[model samples]
Structures are given as structure tokens and as C-alpha cells.
Target: MIRTERIDLEPAFVLHSRRYRETSLLIEAFGHDSGRLAVVARGALRPKSRMRGLLQPFIPLLISWRGRGELATLTAAEAQGEIVPTQGSATLIGFYVNELLLHFLHRHDPEPDLFETYRRTLQRIALEEDPEPSLRIFEKRLLQATGYALQLEREAKSGARIVPDARYIYRPDSGPEPWDPRRHSGAGISGETLLALSEERLSKRDTLREAKQLMRRVIFAHSGEKTLISRNLWRRRRSSDAA
Candidate 1:
């Protein structure tokens, strides 16, 4: 006889949660070994449910669950330890990270490496580190693990190595191609920026800014036509900060 797989006290982080029915919650959790999962935390909405406090984004949790359906039933949950608090821009950045996983990751797909990266990114953000670099690195890793790797190291047209002195435009389907100065009006970037991104070396402020624009375009093109709510909210916060 085959035994059903049951998880008990797994390390996880709540990515997002919503009210389900009258006294429960529909939770999207990122497990260390199980990747992304959707769970129903029964009675979690009650006035004194322990799960109510534990099921929060950016906090490390120890969660127990069972069953083999698309949505598992959460049995128990508790905070693993104290988590550093985030405020202002860091809070928005945390939400953005959660949204990225909820929107892009598929159910039941096991990605242990990505899970570790997520944990580290959150910790970094909580420490008030610059979120841009961490976000960029996570986005690149997510894309690569999900088979949407951006070919930034070479030219798409002639299979030649990208030269730092030239300029190029990144096409979602075809990687980067030489930028035609006379034809294109916008969306092209310097080869130096692309190279910097490929090397994961965004130390220069100009390179980081250019790389942000390029990745935004690439992510938008590949994410189809659906508007990313988190990205929009992030932009609004950024605008408010500027103002």
C-alpha cells in the first residue's frame, strides 16, 4: 500500500492570504522544500486564532498541513522566530516580492534554491539595504529557473559577443540586437549596461538605472498583457517618495 505524503512543521513564509468563506483564509505559502502552495487555514479569521497572527508576509513560519489536493488544509502554524520589521519603501518592496511569486510561480513546483533566495532577499530588505539590486537579482533568477532566461551575453542577430561600446535593443523573443540609431526612437540601451547586468555587477548608478528600465520592458513583454498590481503600487510609492 502507498502512504499519502503529509507535511508537518515545514519551514515556510506566507506570500499572500485572503479571506475564505466566513472564518477561514486562503493562503499562498512558499515552502522550503515544496515551493509555492495554496492552503486553506481553517478558522483562521476567528478573533483568537493563533494562525491569524502567524500567517503574515515576510515572517518565517513553521507550518503543518496534510492532504494531496490542489489546495491543502493547514493544520497548525506558528512564527519560527523574531523577524526584523520593515517600513516605508521596504514594506512596499516586500509586497512587490510576494506579488512576483504569487503571479509567476506555479503550484506544487519545487524550487528550493529560489526559496532560499527569497528568504535572503526579505532579510536584506528588512535591514534597509538597497532593494533594487536584490530585486533585480531575484527577478533574473526567477526568470532563469522558469525557463525565461534573458540572453544578455551575446547578440541575437549575428551570434556575436556584445561589445561594451555599442548600443542595442532587447527583443523578448530574440534577445539583444544592435540598436539602429536612425530607426529606433526609444527602448534601446547601451551595451555596457547590458554587459553589467549579465555580469551581475550593477555597482554603478547609471548602469543600475539603465538595467532597471531594460528589465522592466523585458518583464512586461513576457508577462503578457495583464497589468501587475504590485508593480503599479510600487511605482505609485516611488512617485510619492519623489514628491
Candidate 2:
């Protein structure tokens, strides 16, 4: 007989959800301790179901589950507090963050610090007009938590500290190296941006721009051929606005 795993009142966020069978909902939850897992909410689609508007991405929730296999049954869900909705551009950024978690995290691997980072990121995005800084920071922390941390203050070669006035070319796997236009093919980033990102102090226009470019490249390099749907949607929206 298989022993069932059980968890009760675990702090979690609904990363994604979909219709399941006739009256249930399939949810992908990111628990503070259990990490990413799938749980089916039976009869969630019924007209008077208690979880009608409670199972949504970005909401703080306390969830319970039990199962002997990969997919567990969602036994209960309760909101932790008042819902603070992510609105406007933050919504897209929120989806982007969720997509990163979905792509990078392995099922059943729990990083409590990373969970807190994710929660803080959502709160920051909801409050800030320019959520790019939070997004960049989240990418950096995610990389660090998942064993792909970037070396921002040190050179890939020569073991030298980065100088703010100089320019460097960053390679995702190899870290940053002093830029030599004669040999380097990728874009050159200023040392200022690197240091700012290293310290998570991105603010200036140039620093933010370069940080965005660097983080995007590194994330894509690590993610392989998987394309982010939120990014594609944002790009399409930009193109439409321009047209």
C-alpha cells in the first residue's frame, strides 16, 4: 500500500490554474515549503463553490492537500488576508514572473528564501510604476537560487574586480570580461551597470537599460528554446501601439 503525503495550511500562491474535467480545477501551486506541485480542486466550478474567486495567481493563500501520487487533491483553500490585485502593466510583469518560476523551478524542490523573494517581487511590482528593476532583481535572485548565479563584480578572467568606468562583455556561462571591440561580438555593458546590478540598486536610466539587456540575454541563454508567452504578448502590444 502506498503511503499518502499530507500537508495542512501551507502558505502558497496559485501560479497557474485550468479547468479540470467537468466541475474541477487543476491548480499549480507554489508553496512556501512544498515548492511547485499540482493539486486538483474537485467541484470548484460549481455555482456556489467557496473557491470561486479565491484560486487565482498572486493571491496569498493557505492550502491543504494529500495524495499518494504526483497529482494531489486540494482539500482546502483560504485567503491569508485582503487581496491586493496586480493591475495595468504590473499584470503582465506578474505573469512574466510567474512564467519564470514555472520554467526554472523543479517540482518538489523548495527554496524558502526564493519563495520570499517571489512574494516581495509581486508586492514591489504592484506598487511601482516601473517594474523593470524588480523584474531584473527577481531574475538575478532566481538565477542565484537555481545554481546559475551570475558573477557581477568579478572578471571571468584575471580575477580582477570590476571598474565602474570600463566596459565589459557578459557571457551567460562565463561571467563578464573586459570588452575588446576587436574580438567581442556581443553588446558591451558599462561597469556601472554591473555594479548596480550586483548590489540590486538599479535606478538610473542607463543602468536600468543595460541591466534589462543583460538579464534578458542571460535568462534566455539558460532557458534554452522555451519562449515566454508573457514576453511575446508584451512585444505584440508594443508593436500594435507603435503601429
Best by TM-score: 2
Q: After superposition, how far is residue 153 of candidate 2 from its true place, in Å?
A: 1.2
Tens digits of per-residue lDDT for model 2, 61-154? 9999999777999999999975657987788889899999988998899989999999999998999878888889999999999989999999
lDDT of 1: 0.85
TM-score of each: 0.93, 0.96
- Residue-wise C-alpha lDDT for candidate 1, range 120-202, written one tens digit per residue: 88888878467787778888888777778888889998999988888898888789889987887785888899888878887
Clashing pairs in 2: none
lDDT at residue 67 of model 1 (Cα atoms) = 70
Each model's lDDT: 0.85, 0.91
